[model samples]
Target: MQLAAIREARAAKVAEARRILATAETEKRSLNPAEQSAFDKFKAEITSLEADEQRATFMEDCERRALGDPVGDRSFSAVQRQVNVVEVIRAQMEGRSLSGAAAEFAQETERRTGRKAQGVFVPLSAIESRAVNTTSTAPELVPTIHRADQYIEPFRNSLLARRLGVRVLSGLSGNLSIPKHGTGTTVGWVAENAALPTGDMSFDGVTLAPKHAGGITEQSRQLIMQSSPDIEQLVRDDLSFMLAQAIDSALIKGGGTNEPVGVLSTSGIQTASLATLSWQNVLAMLQKLDIVNASAANIVASTKAKAKLAGTLKAAGIAGYILEGGKVGDLPAYFSNQVAEKTGTPNTGRVIAGDWSQVMLGIWSEVDILVNPYAEGAYSKGNVLIRAMATVDAAVRHPEAFVVADDLAI
Candidate 1:
């Protein structure tokens, strides 16, 4: 019988035994010979059912172990018995899922967490033992593995997105606006006692709404099954880099349709026109900024523009513009290929100088991922497509804090 069926039968037998015992108690007498025989039969059936149940449970546990998975409770001991940590880590490094039992460990973790699972499931004692062994000999693998830091550039290092001031939001979407204080009535100064004129504070609303940014990555089933574990991380990093750059681009040069209004598009920001990038031009843009904004400003330009600026600095022998250690003076300089390299008839490059703090970036907390097994191209290659998407928005709180040096020689 199935486990459920067996359990149900055992329950019925237990109930019968209880009924027999209760009847004798109600009569306030020992069971008669016939009643005693009936009681004994019920007891025998319940005992047999209990043994069957135990055997079923044992069989289930054995199957779970064979599958390299933990049973219902997901306890530590159960995990330890079913997973091989070393094999799991090796599988990850190769950009492939572990076959056989090791794969089960990943599956179980993903089932519980509803996210991609990485790493192993070894006990602390086992890790300590491994550490001890590794300490005596040259470590089998270095403690750290280095990869290109692509994702960090746009969001982690971008002037507008990271260094500049921004208010972070957790929700998927919402409205945001800045308040404007009303001017108090300018009453002429009176000797000591006239009641101060009253004025009302007015608010202006700047609606903040998030737009979607996302991309899809497709890999062959054969590659997933045969490749090394680093492939997974590679895909993850690439997706993140793609989204980060997109959002960063929108923040700098977006047309303000579906995307955020970029710094270049904001009204009333200071501007400088220069035919070529020069130290004096950069300094002029800096000077045009409000003193408050200049205190915390950063410079952002395209790689081409940075190269041009560096050349000009070298020609002029301006050591200050050399950008040693990635900075020029007190301002940190960043390069983004996304910034427009040329615009208008003269084909001018652009440089943005601003206090990033005046820009606000809002994002939904989690990136939504969907795995598709039957996408059009995926079907032919026996592969799957993993698409990641996020919702975000950006707004400038004060345009006066920014200056754009456009019409620069490219």
Candidate 2:
């Protein structure tokens, strides 16, 4: 009898442990040992299954009150079902004598699957960002300005029209050529037999006169004449507006300052000037004014300059340099090759190239300094318009004298 009681006690303990595991598995898919310990402690306090039901009901009532809901009784019923399933499984695991129904259910599950079911929980990192300062003064709200004249809304409408016209003209021109005939076809026979050939069969000058006369007609001349002023104005205005915006933004971000005072100079190669660049001078100028990130561009230039300037800048811990030209394509091959080599490696820095307008736009948009070897004739009035479009809001810090901004707003 004493031995039987000991076996019953051990079975009870095992059953209780299984019940605790089941509750934890239902609440969370998995628990670490610490979390499992908390569940076991709670389970140990319950004197009977009725006590467990009462505790669960009370907890359900509390949750319903906290959530301000009317379904506390239904929630408790669900919790009871979960508790019952866990307790029954625990009892079977502990070697207790199960009821016929419980024994049959356990046997059926064991027959279907030899392994016990388990739950798993995956861990994740918490994402975070800088908190907003509630105590700071409110930012001043700027009113949105709407243009009064729809027709004169910069290049808005004209740009689309110009693009459409170009597309149509290109499509028409594409269809103007004659289609190729298949093999073994002579030019004279193909011209005569072709379905859509311009019939000019006779080789005599008198017979060809009519076809030549048609080419010289006013209608033919009108086709070329029709495409002049509107197209020209459209391109001019679009370029003008874009450049203006780039320069304006650059000036604003670069602290609304005038161009730096110095003779706008250029090196046939940026590497050639690397030795002469004074870091102290550049840093002093940067400190005196608000210049955005300059190190990247400087570093790129240094790299392109190779040992000549890169080593100096790297030793001084200077970070960036700028290249001047209209397009990335326009940069000298030697400089570009050097830049490509250093990209993504440890001694990397930003390299930029553009005409004044493009570089300036890049500066304003990227909040970086515009770098380029200065050139005067590189931006004539017409080309300046194009450059301005390219750089719109960036500061045009080129040394050359050009109208950087439109005094009269378009």
Candidate 3:
């Protein structure tokens, strides 16, 4: 009876094992032929377990080994051995999806950063012709049209060397010609049309072979091999630095912190109770401030009350404006066009405006404001505010006074 009971248990275990095998088989059908064979072999080994006790022991051993437990003995039962077992199968499945997303993000970042170096060749259209030999029957030299493509290789090499942090060794190509006085011997030719910018020398392919003497490591070489993104980034950085320098130079050249030299006076307000200030009086004040340019005066008026006070001060030969209060958005337009019109400056001018308290708290506060002791009430309590700080010139000279003259508030 004990033997019979064991037989029944074994039969039940075999049925359970068959169900697992069927599932694995279904999975195998989705795989290619080679993978299906692997699955079939594993299935066959599992199916060979003859007793329920043996099958349970085998499965438990497999679970332990799959969980990274040591399998000290190799001669264990086939069912107990962990073969083709996957740990973190879910993570492996998700990894494939993540790889695609990562690639797209990297590409977009590169684009936004403007990390792409481009090269173009400007070909020489004409060259001085050599005199024809009267004694020999020779054809006239055909001038080749130079295309920018010829320079691409050297530019790419320079870019690659920069990315790899390797020193570049470049040489110019010599002109290709045989010496007229030499004894019938042919001299080697030189490249004639290579003109690279300063810090980038033209490379002559015929006369000089490209070579690196030292400092090339395995890692650097690998970097150069995949240097496209690095080259692009270098170009982007170079352009930004150049632009910043240009802006700074423009600002300094316009006038280094000099107040706009122009006049300021109010007009057109006359009443017994109110202090009288007229538009004509304001214009006269602007004129007294030495604002001779009409365009400068017009822009200040155009900007109205939002005209940048600092720009106006700069125009009037003052150290710039002290911003007590004003709208921020109008400041740029007010100053930009006026600076361009009056000073012949290009592009938008920069302005920094702040409230009374913030200006006092700022690190560069002293550069922007001044206190007036005589004014009354809120006007007397005004704080010197830096309305605009630009790396470029302001639009209008005495723009603030001009705005006042034009009955504009800015």
Question: Which stretches of candidate 3 lie above 4 Å from their native place?
Answer: 1-234, 250-293, 297-410
How do the residues 358-406 of candidate 2 rate in per-residue lDDT, one tens digit apiece?
Answer: 1221111111011111224422311110111011121223222121110
Assess candidate 2 and give its TM-score to the true structure: 0.14
lDDT of each: 0.57, 0.27, 0.25
Q: What is the lDDT of residue 122 in candidate 3?
A: 8
What C-alpha RMSD separates each model from the true structure? Answer: 25.8, 40.8, 39.1
- Kindly list the per-residue Cα lDDT of model 1 for residues 1-410, writing each as its tens digit: 75645765776566556555655764578888987888899888878888888888778667667876544435434554554433443454345656754455445545443545223322211121100001012357766443323323223333235434444443333355545333444555556777766655555554567677777766555434433444434444455554666676777876556777777777777788767555665666677764532333477777777776665553454355545566755678878667777657766677777766567666532354445667887778666666556667777766777888777777
Q: What is candidate 1's CA lDDT for residue 43? A: 83
**TM-score head-to-head 1 vs 3, winner:** 1
lDDT of 3 by residue, 76-122 (tens): 22312221101111112223321222222223223323332111100
Q: What TM-score does model 1 achieve against the real structure? A: 0.55
| Stretches > 4 Å off in candidate 1 | 1-160, 163-166, 178-201, 225-229, 276-280, 291-294, 313-325
Alpha-carbon error at 195 in model 2, in Å?
89
Give TM per candidate: 0.55, 0.14, 0.16
Candidate 2: residue 64 lDDT (0-100): 59
Worst 10 residues of 1 by lDDT: 127-136
Residue 276 of model 3, lDDT score: 24
